[model samples]
Target: MDDDVERAARKVRDVEQAVSEHVTRGGPVTGRASSPDGAVTVVATPGGPPQSVEVSAAALRMGPHGLAAEIMRIADRAQRNANTRLHQTLERVVDPRELTAMGIERGTDDDESGWRR
Candidate 1:
């Protein structure tokens, strides 16, 4: 019994350490997207917010309306990519079975229902 307790405690500590490291290091939970013409590229964080956007000279030639549309499309793709990355990161830190045992639903990061109870 004591051994089991110690093991569980150790596991908890390990998880805490991993989480701390991930936060401190800003884990690789980012998404990237590029326009079909390779004229615009976007990088976003886990919550689908853009961190950086790069527009090529060729893309700028599209004028305001066309450029704006391309930017929006690329940003959307970037957000989706970020969501996928966040989900994968969660999977790495926590076992799905453990989440189920705790009565937490494991859902894709993109699904609002999945992340919630």
Candidate 2:
């Protein structure tokens, strides 16, 4: 019984350390997205602020409100991409059964984003 308890504790510690390192790494996984009009682009990583935002001169023609809206849309797409990548990365390090138990699972053919909760 004591041996089982010790093994479980060690497993928990190892998982915690892996998570910490992954978060601090900033990005081995990244996502990039661009507006359909090529006006705005965004690069992001999961759980982090956007890594970069590029606004082309063409975006100025949209006026301030339209440009803001486009940026928001592109940013959301970029974040979703990052989230999918992050999910894949986590799957490699964490147990698939554990992720399923948490109600996080990969998407099916109907969804390519690779994550659902």
Candidate 3:
């Protein structure tokens, strides 16, 4: 029992260190996308809404409705991209079994709870 406790504590410490490294140096895992006509671009970070958006002068001519649609489309793509990157990062820092225990499948975009589930 003592050995088991020691092992578990070691695992926890390792996980904590890995998480710290990820946060301090791994950088933000982001996803990015652009409009079909290349007039708009969007970037998203894990567990958050879009972090940045860029619209070219030509995109302004798209008007309200067109611009809205394009933005939505690009935002969706960016979110998916961010999710993928976030998962990859997590895989590197977290134990696969722990993620599985939490019902987080590898490569799945179902992390609607900001990196939870």
Supply the global lDDT for candidate 3: 0.72
| lDDT (tens digit, per residue) of candidate 1 on 21-85 | 77567655667778767899888775646888899998889999999999998887776666655
For model 1, give the 10-residue run with minimal summed lDDT: 108-117
Q: Report each candidate's C-alpha RMSD, comma-separated, in the order given.
A: 9.3, 6.3, 7.3
Quick one: ranking by lDDT, best first? 3, 2, 1
Clashes of 3: 0
- Cα displacement (Å) at residue 85, model 1: 0.8
Scored by CA lDDT, what does every candidate get?
A: 0.69, 0.72, 0.72
Clashes of 1: 0
The deviation in Å at residue 7 for candidate 1 is 23
Best by TM-score: 3
Better of 1 and 2 by lDDT: 2
Model 3 worst lDDT window (10 residues) = 108-117
Residue clash pairs of candidate 3: none
